[model samples]
Target: MRILVVEDQDSIRRMIEALVQARGYEVTAVSSGAKALDVILTAPHDLVLLDLMLPGQYDGFEVCRRLRADPSTRAIPVFIISAMDDPESRRKATEAGANAFYTKPFSPIALLKEIERLTTGKG
Candidate 1:
Protein backbone atom coordinates (compact mmCIF):
# COMPACT_ATOMS: atom_id res chain seq x y z
CA MET A 1 0.00 0.00 0.00
CA ARG A 2 1.02 3.61 -0.43
CA ILE A 3 1.95 5.57 2.68
CA LEU A 4 2.67 9.28 2.84
CA VAL A 5 4.93 10.39 5.66
CA VAL A 6 4.96 14.08 6.57
CA GLU A 7 7.67 15.13 8.96
CA ASP A 8 9.67 18.37 9.12
CA GLN A 9 12.74 16.97 10.76
CA ASP A 10 15.07 15.55 8.19
CA SER A 11 16.55 12.82 10.33
CA ILE A 12 13.18 11.76 11.65
CA ARG A 13 11.60 11.73 8.23
CA ARG A 14 14.42 9.64 6.81
CA MET A 15 14.23 7.19 9.66
CA ILE A 16 10.50 6.78 9.29
CA GLU A 17 10.74 6.39 5.51
CA ALA A 18 13.42 3.77 5.89
CA LEU A 19 11.51 1.81 8.49
CA VAL A 20 8.26 1.89 6.57
CA GLN A 21 9.96 0.99 3.31
CA ALA A 22 11.81 -1.84 4.96
CA ARG A 23 8.46 -3.39 5.75
CA GLY A 24 7.67 -3.67 2.02
CA TYR A 25 5.40 -0.67 1.61
CA GLU A 26 5.49 2.10 -0.94
CA VAL A 27 6.29 5.36 0.87
CA THR A 28 6.24 8.99 -0.23
CA ALA A 29 7.75 11.36 2.31
CA VAL A 30 7.78 15.15 2.47
CA SER A 31 9.47 17.75 4.62
CA SER A 32 6.53 20.09 4.95
CA GLY A 33 2.81 19.89 5.34
CA ALA A 34 2.33 22.01 2.23
CA LYS A 35 4.10 19.48 0.03
CA ALA A 36 2.16 16.76 1.76
CA LEU A 37 -1.14 18.45 0.92
CA ASP A 38 -0.10 18.93 -2.66
CA VAL A 39 0.88 15.31 -2.99
CA ILE A 40 -2.24 13.95 -1.32
CA LEU A 41 -4.67 16.09 -3.28
CA THR A 42 -3.00 15.20 -6.54
CA ALA A 43 -2.59 11.49 -6.00
CA PRO A 44 -4.11 8.73 -3.93
CA HIS A 45 -2.52 7.34 -0.81
CA ASP A 46 -3.61 4.51 1.44
CA LEU A 47 -2.43 6.04 4.70
CA VAL A 48 -0.74 9.16 6.08
CA LEU A 49 1.76 9.39 8.90
CA LEU A 50 1.83 13.06 9.92
CA ASP A 51 3.85 15.10 12.36
CA LEU A 52 2.07 17.76 14.39
CA MET A 53 4.50 20.66 14.09
CA LEU A 54 5.33 21.76 10.58
CA PRO A 55 7.24 24.73 9.07
CA GLY A 56 4.79 25.96 6.48
CA GLN A 57 1.45 27.74 6.39
CA TYR A 58 -0.21 24.44 7.29
CA ASP A 59 0.54 22.14 10.16
CA GLY A 60 -0.29 18.46 10.35
CA PHE A 61 -3.53 19.18 12.16
CA GLU A 62 -4.63 21.52 9.40
CA VAL A 63 -3.63 18.96 6.78
CA CYS A 64 -5.66 16.31 8.54
CA ARG A 65 -8.60 18.68 8.85
CA ARG A 66 -8.47 19.52 5.18
CA LEU A 67 -8.21 15.90 4.20
CA ARG A 68 -11.11 15.03 6.44
CA ALA A 69 -13.15 17.95 5.16
CA ASP A 70 -12.85 17.01 1.51
CA PRO A 71 -15.17 14.20 0.51
CA SER A 72 -12.69 12.75 -1.93
CA THR A 73 -9.99 12.30 0.69
CA ARG A 74 -12.18 12.02 3.77
CA ALA A 75 -11.94 8.26 4.04
CA ILE A 76 -8.15 8.11 3.70
CA PRO A 77 -6.68 6.99 6.99
CA VAL A 78 -4.52 9.60 8.77
CA PHE A 79 -2.32 8.73 11.68
CA ILE A 80 -0.65 11.50 13.67
CA ILE A 81 2.95 10.60 14.37
CA SER A 82 4.22 13.48 16.45
CA ALA A 83 6.51 14.33 19.32
CA MET A 84 3.71 16.01 21.21
CA ASP A 85 2.76 13.31 23.64
CA ASP A 86 0.38 15.21 25.87
CA PRO A 87 -3.30 14.68 26.55
CA GLU A 88 -4.21 17.93 24.81
CA SER A 89 -2.23 17.03 21.72
CA ARG A 90 -3.89 13.66 21.59
CA ARG A 91 -7.27 15.28 21.99
CA LYS A 92 -6.56 17.78 19.23
CA ALA A 93 -5.40 14.99 16.93
CA THR A 94 -8.60 13.08 17.62
CA GLU A 95 -10.66 16.21 17.05
CA ALA A 96 -8.83 16.75 13.78
CA GLY A 97 -10.04 13.32 12.63
CA ALA A 98 -6.95 11.15 12.88
CA ASN A 99 -7.46 7.41 12.55
CA ALA A 100 -4.67 6.68 15.01
CA PHE A 101 -1.96 8.45 17.05
CA TYR A 102 1.70 7.63 17.61
CA THR A 103 4.24 9.68 19.50
CA LYS A 104 7.83 10.21 18.38
CA PRO A 105 10.16 7.30 19.03
CA PHE A 106 7.17 5.18 18.16
CA SER A 107 7.25 1.46 17.95
CA PRO A 108 7.94 0.39 14.38
CA ILE A 109 6.11 -2.85 14.97
CA ALA A 110 2.95 -1.11 16.08
CA LEU A 111 3.07 1.18 13.08
CA LEU A 112 3.47 -1.71 10.69
CA LYS A 113 0.65 -3.59 12.34
CA GLU A 114 -1.65 -0.58 12.22
CA ILE A 115 -0.87 -0.06 8.55
CA GLU A 116 -1.65 -3.68 7.89
CA ARG A 117 -4.92 -3.39 9.74
CA LEU A 118 -5.99 -0.12 8.18
CA THR A 119 -5.08 -0.90 4.62
CA THR A 120 -6.06 -4.55 4.33
CA GLY A 121 -8.39 -5.04 7.31
CA LYS A 122 -5.87 -7.56 8.64
CA GLY A 123 -2.96 -7.39 11.03
Candidate 2:
Protein backbone atom coordinates (compact mmCIF):
# COMPACT_ATOMS: atom_id res chain seq x y z
CA MET A 1 0.00 0.00 0.00
CA ARG A 2 1.06 3.56 -0.58
CA ILE A 3 1.16 5.90 2.45
CA LEU A 4 1.93 9.51 3.02
CA VAL A 5 3.48 10.77 6.24
CA VAL A 6 3.39 14.51 6.96
CA GLU A 7 5.73 15.23 9.82
CA ASP A 8 8.00 18.25 10.42
CA GLN A 9 10.49 16.64 12.77
CA ASP A 10 13.25 15.13 10.67
CA SER A 11 14.17 12.40 13.11
CA ILE A 12 10.61 11.41 13.84
CA ARG A 13 9.70 11.49 10.19
CA ARG A 14 12.66 9.34 9.24
CA MET A 15 11.85 6.91 12.01
CA ILE A 16 8.29 6.50 10.85
CA GLU A 17 9.43 6.14 7.29
CA ALA A 18 11.91 3.45 8.20
CA LEU A 19 9.33 1.54 10.22
CA VAL A 20 6.74 1.74 7.50
CA GLN A 21 9.25 0.79 4.85
CA ALA A 22 10.20 -2.20 6.94
CA ARG A 23 6.55 -3.22 6.81
CA GLY A 24 6.94 -3.53 3.02
CA TYR A 25 4.84 -0.52 2.19
CA GLU A 26 5.82 2.36 -0.07
CA VAL A 27 5.87 5.68 1.76
CA THR A 28 6.13 9.31 0.79
CA ALA A 29 7.32 11.54 3.63
CA VAL A 30 6.97 15.30 3.62
CA SER A 31 7.66 18.00 6.19
CA SER A 32 4.56 20.13 5.77
CA GLY A 33 0.85 19.75 5.23
CA ALA A 34 0.94 21.90 2.10
CA LYS A 35 3.48 19.65 0.42
CA ALA A 36 1.42 16.69 1.47
CA LEU A 37 -1.61 18.24 -0.17
CA ASP A 38 0.31 18.80 -3.34
CA VAL A 39 1.32 15.17 -3.54
CA ILE A 40 -2.12 13.96 -2.54
CA LEU A 41 -3.63 16.01 -5.32
CA THR A 42 -1.22 14.66 -7.88
CA ALA A 43 -1.27 10.99 -6.97
CA PRO A 44 -3.22 8.43 -5.03
CA HIS A 45 -2.31 7.30 -1.55
CA ASP A 46 -4.00 4.50 0.33
CA LEU A 47 -3.59 6.18 3.68
CA VAL A 48 -2.12 9.22 5.41
CA LEU A 49 -0.27 9.63 8.72
CA LEU A 50 -0.54 13.29 9.60
CA ASP A 51 1.07 15.33 12.37
CA LEU A 52 -1.14 17.83 14.17
CA MET A 53 1.56 20.44 14.64
CA LEU A 54 2.60 21.36 11.10
CA PRO A 55 4.72 24.21 9.77
CA GLY A 56 2.30 25.77 7.34
CA GLN A 57 -0.90 27.75 7.10
CA TYR A 58 -2.83 24.54 7.49
CA ASP A 59 -2.35 22.41 10.57
CA GLY A 60 -3.16 18.72 10.44
CA PHE A 61 -6.74 19.44 11.43
CA GLU A 62 -7.16 21.94 8.62
CA VAL A 63 -5.42 19.62 6.22
CA CYS A 64 -7.70 16.78 7.22
CA ARG A 65 -10.71 19.04 6.73
CA ARG A 66 -9.51 20.03 3.31
CA LEU A 67 -8.93 16.43 2.33
CA ARG A 68 -12.36 15.48 3.52
CA ALA A 69 -13.86 18.38 1.62
CA ASP A 70 -12.34 17.30 -1.63
CA PRO A 71 -14.38 14.77 -3.53
CA SER A 72 -11.40 12.77 -4.70
CA THR A 73 -9.85 12.43 -1.27
CA ARG A 74 -12.88 12.43 1.00
CA ALA A 75 -12.85 8.65 1.35
CA ILE A 76 -9.16 8.27 2.06
CA PRO A 77 -8.16 7.09 5.52
CA VAL A 78 -6.22 9.54 7.70
CA PHE A 79 -4.62 8.91 11.07
CA ILE A 80 -3.62 11.89 13.17
CA ILE A 81 -0.25 11.55 14.85
CA SER A 82 0.41 14.15 17.49
CA ALA A 83 1.95 14.83 20.89
CA MET A 84 -1.13 16.70 22.05
CA ASP A 85 -2.32 14.22 24.60
CA ASP A 86 -5.75 15.50 25.52
CA PRO A 87 -9.31 14.35 25.11
CA GLU A 88 -10.13 17.56 23.30
CA SER A 89 -7.37 16.98 20.81
CA ARG A 90 -8.67 13.52 20.07
CA ARG A 91 -12.18 14.84 19.72
CA LYS A 92 -11.04 17.58 17.39
CA ALA A 93 -9.16 15.07 15.25
CA THR A 94 -12.23 12.90 14.94
CA GLU A 95 -14.37 15.94 14.20
CA ALA A 96 -11.88 16.98 11.57
CA GLY A 97 -12.33 13.53 9.95
CA ALA A 98 -9.32 11.51 11.06
CA ASN A 99 -9.90 7.75 11.06
CA ALA A 100 -7.62 7.34 14.08
CA PHE A 101 -5.69 9.47 16.62
CA TYR A 102 -2.26 8.52 17.89
CA THR A 103 -0.19 10.50 20.36
CA LYS A 104 3.57 10.95 20.24
CA PRO A 105 5.89 8.32 21.72
CA PHE A 106 3.56 5.90 20.03
CA SER A 107 4.38 2.27 19.44
CA PRO A 108 5.57 1.72 15.92
CA ILE A 109 4.11 -1.76 15.78
CA ALA A 110 0.80 -0.62 17.17
CA LEU A 111 0.67 2.22 14.68
CA LEU A 112 1.40 -0.15 11.82
CA LYS A 113 -1.23 -2.55 13.08
CA GLU A 114 -3.80 0.23 13.10
CA ILE A 115 -2.76 1.29 9.63
CA GLU A 116 -3.16 -2.25 8.38
CA ARG A 117 -6.57 -2.52 9.91
CA LEU A 118 -7.73 0.75 8.38
CA THR A 119 -6.41 -0.02 4.93
CA THR A 120 -7.54 -3.60 4.99
CA GLY A 121 -11.11 -2.80 6.06
CA LYS A 122 -10.78 -4.47 9.42
CA GLY A 123 -11.06 -1.27 11.53
Best by TM-score: 2
TM-score of each: 0.95, 0.97
Counting only residues 3 or more apart in sequence or on different chains, how many pairs clash (N, Cα, C under 3 Å) in candidate 2? 0
Q: Give me candidate 2's TM-score against the actual structure.
A: 0.97
Which clashing pairs does model 2 show?
Answer: none
- lDDT at position 72, candidate 2: 99
Worst 10 residues of 2 by lDDT: 114-123
The sequence of per-residue lDDT tens digits that candidate 2 reaches over residues 1-123 is 999999999999999999999999999999998999999999899999999999979899999999999999999999999999899889999999999998989998899999999999885
RMSD of 2: 0.8
Q: What value of lDDT does candidate 2 attain over all alpha carbons? A: 0.95
Give the CA lDDT, 0 to 100, for residue 83 in model 2. Answer: 98
Candidate 1's C-alpha runs over 4 A off are none
